[model samples]
Target: MTKSTFHAAPLLTLCLVLWALPLGAQKKKDNLQKPMAGPRATALRVSWLYVSADLGAQKVGRVQIGREIVVAEKSSDWLRVFANTDIEEEHTSDAPIFDTNDTPPPISGWIQAKGIVIDNTPNGDQILMGAAADQEALASDPRGPVNAARTAHLLYRRLVEMFPNSPLAAEAAWRAADILWQLQKADSSSRPSAKEQAPYLRDQMDEDGLKKVIKFYPNTRQADFAAYELLDNKLCGDWQGQEKCPEKESEIYEKYAAEHPESPRTPQALYLAVYRQAVLTDMYTADNNDKKSDAAHNHARELAAKLRDKFPQSDYTARATMLVFKLDQRIPVYGIEKE
Candidate 1:
């Protein structure tokens, strides 16, 4: 999923070609005459990391200082190192967060060992920053939407699995789950059935990754949107393991409305609860259970009325008003009278 607009800090530049070539051409005067001649040492400040200990090796990326790293297995003037990958997640808050976290494999490269110091303290943020660099580069590729989404899903899932606590983890999970729902060729003509959904959607990951964001990280902004996806228009069949519109589906919406009344999402919850009940009436009607259908219709009418009275200014008010009339008409025809 694309992040909502926010003032994000500048993203780290790590991809080899996109970043190194331009900088390499400009810094000729300050370039080291030769590789450092000393014992292996940790990178002290922001410096270029190379694919080999030799000064001539391909430049992979630059690393932030204070990232504890191991030495090269063989002797060389350069220090061979792997990017750190232990970033901790952000703290829970009601605030909006827009950054994404990626946890792909670390980029291995060598750096000049001259000013580097001997140290081994790892920083979670550093590891996470490196991951973020790799994922962003892959995502920005000009590959067609279908192909790009497929590749992004892999990296996003890795971020979620490797750094569940990072602020970006929730966003990554959201993207991975959302992409699967869009893989079909929608621009063609007709909508496809569940089987018609991307062939690998179910294979990439289950629905748990999406739902867990609400349960495990409710305070994060991503959970609110994730909840919306889980309850999409009251259809919980796609949520958790429910095969149909289970009772729990409506409960989740109503509960979200009651608990997060101050959230901008509260109106959506209230409105969807009315919709869910209305759909249930249709389900029973299709099953030829008139009594149940009337009962459900009346219940939906009650919810729609409540929605109208509680938030008359909301756009849902117009829909809920019509819903009340529609369900009211059906309720009486099914032989249900006002109590």
Candidate 2:
């Protein structure tokens, strides 16, 4: 559960590749600037980019609410921007295109200035955060917009990039990373490899964004949450009736619990460890390894006791208590149940 401390080496390499532009090269090339040089902005509502400043100008593309943009110039009521419009189509939304070094080329056009929020806009961070939350809610609903989740992810990322000093920055970063992770997880879970017993057989969730959250926002609750998400990549896709799967996974969860004792996920982690131990008890008994079975039973009880002592009010603690009672009554926690 304890990963190697993240360093800037990978990021440094990426920077060299993406931002090695000669001085003034960015400005000379179609007025497109590095993201940091321009005033970061997002659409406050679904809008359109036009080929010209006039309302009758040909439509260049539709800009979804929360799509990130960088303003290079502004007219009376129009802003010239380089918008991140290379997003994957809604039908093939499995791939996320927001990585620092892997971003798609931007589209340049004029957008109406009315519905845009720039970095200097008053309370812009709060406005962006609220928009992201609304999008997230839509993403969770079956009848919501097809691209709501992606928009939410983009909005959250913009909040962190534009308002790094905002009190909401840490949570925004975590939310962005979590949304991407969940999208990737859902995509991976639908593949045939998802039926594999070993997690490595399936596609792995990208860890770069999660690692960035931990790197930039260390010691925060969001960092702890990000770390907890990383564990998903190491878990078994299916236990496959193997005691070793649960045994190793239990150790991993226990280590996370010990390292991040105050994390909101710690109680659930402890409960997972207890559940695995209970499964191990049944598996060992089936193998006629009475000694190991007895040991696992005792360990399960001990971990359950710890959960109750440390998180008495937690739902996980209550679940662990029920598990312990079933163990004491010689009930099978795995395999076919007795009638």
Candidate 3:
């Protein structure tokens, strides 16, 4: 071969190797997190993970109800599997996991196949949704499992991920996001900064999942629910005896009502606007600003009228009526009444 041909051959080999390096690295990275090759499954009850397929085998851990697993092999009534066993510690006080990447490695063990629901199981989406609803109810009970909320959240998430085309996917996604938002709200409320008047002064709940629900399920009732939850981030932590607090909050609620007239939350938003304007009327009265106070009173009455006209049978309309009565009677809706 010519000397130039030899040199060109080496150069071509080097170029090919350089091009393959990134692909090779990406493949390795993907392999590191690749789920076990098997049908995705979840437990129907609290099941024990054993070192072997026998009931007498050493117990390694547990598979909580609705926790995702991959069925790799089976022996009669027992199945060998890889399961996500990341059980968070029971928190005595409100606390939230800040790190999203804290997933523990999946544990490999054997569990009973009797209660295992696979992705292809008939009515699997409904089954998962029911299980998640059960867990959510348990989460609300004072004596229920500490991780019930988190488990329900995960189960709902798994339903959405595993059965994206199912009829229940949108609702499942909303429930998952709502659970996480509530959990974060509880933790944020427990902090000292929660007493601050401005929302910016306090820790905020993560909004990415809620935003995803709105993005992926537009025009759905679930999307409307997510949009209402987003308003919590814009609210004052505490009114702090300020007129501006109610003034600003009333505007926020009024805008929400106008923009989402068909939303289920519209009545509540209107009621909130009425309530805040009533409070502002009181605040302005206390400040001896009669002009602003009269304007606030008129606005409160107008919102109450809107509530009654728009949502005649709504409970919020009744509440708005009561607020209007108080405003007309000169009863203070906020702070102490003038002696």
Candidate 4:
């Protein structure tokens, strides 16, 4: 055989292999997005989870490729699961974490069962959907009353644990913190006083957890919430009678606002940043330390003024106006005296 003829045959064979690559790649992508419907279903295989078990059910949400389902119940083709933000709560009162009657309603849904690929558990098509689907799905559950909210929080934690290296990890972690905060407020509304609510709020949404979310997913929406929550939320300590750590709140807000100039979070964060600085002044005066109050008052005023000029139309601007007035007139901040 002539050398040129042999080369032509080899070139044709290579061309055929190259031609098939896209189809094979596409098939793999589809498999990762959803498992083949078979005799048994596994959790975390479907990309777009159906609202119902029926194959034709409308898409209600998505299950991340690797999110673990507690799987309270399952049919041959579908699994029932829950998803949400996870928050840590400490028992502040003798009150059962919640009244036995108040057990959070289970947030439940159905998803097709799929299989796990044990050998390729950590990489490739399993990791990216170009955007974070499972992470978002883990968070996508509609905010609900305490019961459903609690379940959703559990789901977030599951996603984080099951896919620690996935891009969605930050989102899952943030949702977990957010849910716990919401649950905390709900639990406390029925209670009598700050002393009573103090315990419940003490350790909920630990500071380090929020910091980790921001550290890993700095520009994501989850990070934005984590950053803001670390300041304005209890994660940074806004209560009294417990180990007080409210002094650091203003610094976090200022740093977050400065770092993300155009972030939507910046407007609100700047406003709260100023609010918390005034809080320090108020706290000092409340504690009978007028000398310690002066620096915070000055800084708060500067931040308030900056907000007034930079974000005149922000939702927090009116509050900024009130902040300036209070700082100047030395009006005792309404809640500061007691809290």
Candidate 5:
């Protein structure tokens, strides 16, 4: 779904907010071009999910420097790193906030994660700054609807740009496609002049990206959302809506049914296609006063009958049947002069 306009922040504004900091503090640049552990050093090993290491309280602001690996007696546990800080600030705090006894620092860096750093210290504010940057980036995105619909289209384009072929990328693609479909339904007018409508057509070029995500990660939560969104978007419009609607249910029904005939959702998909066609036809005939022909009304009656006969247990059967009765009542009497 699109986020509220009130919540959207411009990307530049977000960058500025994230980078703003107190002046005169020096940031250390890593001098080593590449890591070099001598032949005697053992390589550092850690798991992505759970690697335990104790960070000492003294090492708060200073950067921890160490070889990639150390020899002989190294255990499987993560190696502890320390930063020596002045005792004056440490002691001056009102409470005993410092965990002097083998406590670990909350800040951490993932091996795969990479980005520009902005902070006063190498360790403390640095990590916080990275998180802040990410948060600001997320906040700055103005992708959601600005109207009552609360529709947001997360473009897979952005996801693929930031992360390629990763799980997060897959997730982003799925969410983006889902949001795009919601935006389509909530705002029928995707024309540039329609300010209330989100600009998905202009923004997205990630159909292939989305397909890859669904193909590779069908069991993921985002994949499930993508599947539903694809279904909904595919079923939202009728043949008459071809020019206005990005997706057409009639087309989708034919394809989905042919491909997955045994699928449990096949019935629902076909029902929606017929229902949309009938609804749109009925609405057009009713609005135009049927001056030219009774084609639309006749089609609606035919579709309604088909719905009732073919899917006796469908919920749409009741609604369609009701519409048929209503149409019958109105056809002979509507807009005619009384004697």
Candidate 6:
């Protein structure tokens, strides 16, 4: 046969063989030739997690795809099994063919792109949704919370820097703080203090930090409470034993009352002031035996008069009035004897 004819004959025969074998059979043969990982079937490692949902109506066992999220605490969906490792692409084969360089095929592209939910609280959805822009920027790629938080931190920092005067800037600042705090909390190496955890709370602050908040957002509702916290912290500390305790407490009350006369906590501030004065004066009189003493007599009389006149409706008013009358009865031999 001619060279051209001989080649054409083989090509025709090849076409016939290709056409004759059905698609399904060819696919089956290909699958059969694929090498398998080992004798055991490829299966993921899974664990059962106890879950309470439906107000404890349904107790379920779940496999943890990732971490337990706070939001999941209330979810009705009982269980989730997740893939731990990549799946082997090799199938069962008769021939012992080994490819040392071949790697397992990764999971479905989309399932991984969803990443893992951390907090899973009511607010979690918002945080995740907010991250969509970021996820898209990373080329539909995926990573864990640690990397996600780092990305979020960068975004918030940029937002804060770019919009310094905007509320969004403040929010971003808080978010950045929260992300750092969360990362620290998630780390098992060390624990953080209440003060250290304050940043993660987002615009919320500890006592010292609240002072800064009050200063920065003076008219804000948060500042109103912050101011009270500052004053409460000061008053409840060492001031109680000092000679100027009553006076300092009184000054704080007056200032707070003046600044926020209509505030709900105004009564509380006033009560604290009056209480301090009454107690201190009582201590002074009880300590000094001499009724003729100027400091004791003057302070006791002054506080009693102040409470009766200024805070008649106060809870301490009735008690203070009786004290004033008692002080009146003790005014003998001071050149101003009681009638």
Candidate 1 lDDT at 153 equals 50
Candidate 6: Cα lDDT at 303 = 54
lDDT of 1: 0.52
| Candidate 4 stretches greater than 4 Å from native | 1-146, 154-173, 184-201, 204-212, 231-247, 259-263, 279-294, 334-339
lDDT of 3 by residue, 71-117 (tens): 77888989888776654422211333222254344677999888788
Between candidates 2 and 5, name the one with more favorable TM-score: 2
Instruction: Quote the positional error of residue 183 for candidate 3 in Å.
Output: 1.9
lDDT of 4 by residue, 1-339 (tens): 211110011212222333344454665534333222212112334345567788788866654443333343467867655421121222212334323363322234676655422212445224332223434454445652334454455445544544556666666677666766655655544445433333345433345556656666667787777666655344332355321444555666778788776667787877877777777777777777877788878887888777888889887877877887887887766354332
Looking at candidate 6, what is the lDDT of residue 44? 15
Worst 10 residues of 6 by lDDT: 36-45
TM-score-better candidate, 5 vs 6: 5
Ranking by lDDT: 2, 3, 4, 1, 6, 5
Tens-digit lDDT track of model 6 for 140-184: 255544345555554443333223444444444444444444444
**Using alpha carbons, what is the TM-score of model 1?**
0.44
Which tens-of-lDDT digit does each residue in 117-169 have in candidate 5? 21112442223323323433444467622421211122232223223433355
Flag the better candidate by lDDT, 1 or 6: 1
Q: Write the per-residue lDDT of candidate 1 for residues 212-318, one digit (tens) a residue.
A: 56665666667776666554423322433221443456777888877666556766777777776776776667678889777767777777777777777888867
Higher-TM-score candidate among 1 and 4? 4
List the lowest-lDDT window of 10 residues for candidate 5. 38-47
The window of 10 residues in a row where model 3 has the poorest summed lDDT is 2-11
Residue pairs clashing in model 2 are none
Superposed by TM-score, candidate 3 places the C-alpha of residue 110 at a distance from the truth, in angstroms, of 2.5
All models: lDDT?
0.52, 0.81, 0.80, 0.53, 0.37, 0.40
Among these predicted structures, which one has the highest TM-score?
A: 2
What is the overall TM-score of model 2 with all chains considered together? 0.85
Q: After superposition, how far is residue 127 of candidate 3 from its true place, in Å?
A: 1.2
Give candidate 4's error at residue 28 in angstroms.
33
